[model samples]
Target: MGQFYCLHCDRYFANSTVRDEHFKTKRHKKRMKQMSGPAPHTQLDAELAAGMVGKARAPDCRGTLGAVEGLPFIFLLM
Candidate 1:
């Protein structure tokens, strides 16, 4: 992996492919637009995630889930 700093976006990217993908994602464009306007409530999202994780884990009744060991690996590969 390699690092590249995108000055226009004011962020560091791990690789060129990821950086290109970011440029194509709605979020990055939205962030740039927000920079000229208003930023989203990211702190609120963090708080929500924290609260959810803080709650006791209930068994996932939706279905039997296998170990989530390779989820990220699978996503990245895809």
Candidate 2:
């Protein structure tokens, strides 16, 4: 038996047909969109841009996540 691999989805399929079908799935499409560019702007991004949530640090920057006045404290790992 031969296995077809989808690099984007990091999944293996039985054949090309199955792999191609998976590429059309919503999950795969969403992943592709996310990987293609920066994340879509939201309230949090807006606040960060406006300096309302303190300084927006890079993903690799090391710092403490202190309390923000009007925002919930959340931690993200990169």
Candidate 3:
């Protein structure tokens, strides 16, 4: 359950150490090269990527876990 996913490559790691290792690997870096850049997506973009309906919603300020996919990698709400 503890893992970090590579957004660019859609890969996952069990821990930060492994994640860091993956980041350093040639294959991982190569995959990263395929990305447009490190620009963060806007809330609207993130919502669309998460497959939500019109009017992107922000996660509850109460810090509750809501609908999500590939959790730990992408949080759709919160």
Evaluated with TM-score, which candidate comes out highest?
Answer: 2
Off by over 4 Å in 2: 38-78
Better of 1 and 3 by lDDT: 3
Worst 10 residues of 2 by lDDT: 60-69
The C-alpha TM-scores of every prediction are 0.35, 0.43, 0.41
lDDT-based ranking, best first?
2, 3, 1
Model 3 CA deviation exceeding 4 Å by range: 37-78
Instruction: Give the TM-score (vs. native) of candidate 3.
Output: 0.41
**In model 1, which runs have C-alpha deviations exceeding 4 angstroms?**
7-10, 37-78
| Candidate 2 lDDT by residue in tens digits, 3-71 | 898776778988899888999999999888877885455575565555576435534222322223344
- TM-score, model 1 to reference: 0.35
Instruction: Write down the lDDT of every candidate, Cα atoms only.
Output: 0.55, 0.65, 0.61
Task: For candidate 2, list the clashing residue pairs, or say none.
Answer: none
- Better structure of 1 and 3 per TM-score: 3
Prediction-by-prediction clash tally: 0, 0, 0
